[model samples]
Target: MKATDPSQPRERALLVQVVLGRRDRREAEDSLAELERLADSAGAATIGCITQRRDRPTPGLFVGEGKLVDIQLACREGKANVVIFDNELSAVQVNNLDLALGIKVIDRTEVILQIFARRARSAEAKVQVELAQLQYLISRIPVSRKQQRFQGGIGMRGPGESPLQLRNAPMRRRISDLKRRLDRIGKRHASVRKRRPWPLVSLVGYTNAGKSTLLNACTQAGAYVDDRLFATLDTKTRLVHVPENRKLLLTDTVGFIRHLPHGLVASFRSTLDVARESDLLLLIADAADPGIATQIDVVHETLAEIEAEAVPYMIVLNKSDAATQDQLDHLLAIHHDAVVVSARKGEGLDKLKARIVEELLAHDVHFPGENDHG
Candidate 1:
């Protein structure tokens, strides 16, 4: 509600979750906790949280009328200016909720899209994020255009300087044009890959699991790294040099997350396709996260969804410096074959590199000398 700066006001958000059948209270809490992190990543301060048990989502509102009233009271009492839903909401549902709550209402997918829109730096990533954003907004346009609209921040931020909401006809044209442009970009990337004479290896992991940090540690690629979720959206390939002058191409890719939207998966396939093409994948994970196993499972599920399951992968537990000895041991004991490293502190990287060399050699590709990857 406070806005000294119109373009970048601090959002005070109320987190909401609906517990459907079969998902217990703990699971719902875990999800809400994750959503809170997402809100924080989008530069919002969480002011309150509300959860409701529902047999099924009410047709127009995700929550029951009583629960909706409860939420209204919470929003006023807690002074929340925004509401972020853990579950995906229909466009109509979002519209109705916005009217009822008297604030911005966005679902999980929109939050993820907002992060992608802001994090995208390269031309390719920008294109992918834009196309995805357009696809998402095309459906929400009719509902949004009818409303008196809350402006600027989170779901409102997107590619370029243009206004986000556009006419359906023009927006469809934009989506098609973006798809074609992305297709060309994907083909160009493929052509470049064909020209490169080294084995391809990509780093895949949950968001903010230190893939870029590992990349910088290994190849000194100086990739952009941030502590927030979805920090690096661009695909960066750098040549990793091992002993005896043998080298392989290493790529840092966008990180995966639990419940990553299906639309995002389709839209960013051009970027994610790198993992599918790789001879080997370094499945990175944060050693400190108690949810490390679940995060690893999500990455594996995403890889399978992208048809990258056939590719051989090694689990690399990174950020060992942040993890307690007990945590590290717990992970290592569970993942006996896993490589441990602190990409930020430059610890255990040599051993990780040695494993990489072994894995790449197993694929049996001859490396050419002194070529810096792009």
Candidate 2:
């Protein structure tokens, strides 16, 4: 999806989700909640939501015709100008939904790419995100053109006028150009990494999991932190001084989310390489989230996808101040060695630093941060 144009009116969005088989209703609802956060991050005002239970999505429109009608009604009553789905939609499905609902229709992948595009600041990030967005559009060019971004140009003018190959030529050349640019950026990044002397430690976690906040607390990096999804798209690296004047290179990376678009992951490979090459990974998570376990698993899955799972990691359960004592105790019992800390409140950071020392030095050396001020 294209980034919302600031000059245009704010988009009011109607969210849609489908529950398959006997899947947990709560899980689907939680996913919808996260989608709402994504919509909010994209500067869209979510006005309503629609959910359906089905063994599988209908082939063409995704939802059944009756459900489609219901969605149209919701859009009218809610005054929504857009419909965002929690499910992945085929190009045909997106086109059909757009025509049926008489509004912009984008799926989860589009929404995520839109967020990444909007939040990207650095030149490398901008290239990476633009590449990903183009790659996503490449698959849909033959069918869907309502995204408005592809509304102009050759293949985007509609599929039938020119031969499919001819229509695809311009987009193909543009994609190749973006990839070449990204490759140069990647090589430069690698050269910088090779010259850095300190051992690098990377922070990885679910979106909005306080990774940025923790970076700020630990290194005073003044990294951007927001209570919204994908707030930090570019990695922020800082020199972290542990006790005894020993130094470690720490970085806060783009946070992971469930069902992260494969195109987005491939495009961000250069940025996420910091994780795969790190001396250690701090797999931080929100300790208070009711779905904490699932979120942690999602992070693990993403690390593996990026081939960062081999890097030794220590779990730092953040947001302890917001969790009940029972919740903390239960998590600690399960993730026995995990450190509990509240980045917002500066609590239990000493223990986390001590653990980092042990992990980094390959011995049981302890830091003198036995309290909040590590």
Which lDDT values do the candidates have, in the order given?
A: 0.86, 0.88
Query: Pairing residues by index, what is the TM-score of model 1?
Result: 0.87
* lDDT (C-alpha) at residue 318 in model 1: 92
Tens-digit lDDT string for candidate 1 (185-223)? 999998898888888889999998999999999988999
Report how far off residue 44 is in candidate 2 (Å): 1.3
lDDT of 2 at 304: 89
Judged by lDDT, which candidate is best?
A: 2
Per-model C-alpha RMSD: 7.9, 7.1
Q: lDDT by residue for model 2 over 52-141, one digit each (tens)?
A: 999999998999999998999999999999999999999889888888888999998999998898899999899999899888988876
Residue 61 deviation, candidate 2, in Å?
A: 0.7
The stretch of ten residues in a row with the least summed lDDT in candidate 2 is 363-372
List of clashing residue pairs for candidate 2: none
| Candidate 2 overall lDDT versus native | 0.88
Per-model TM-score on C-alpha atoms:
0.87, 0.89
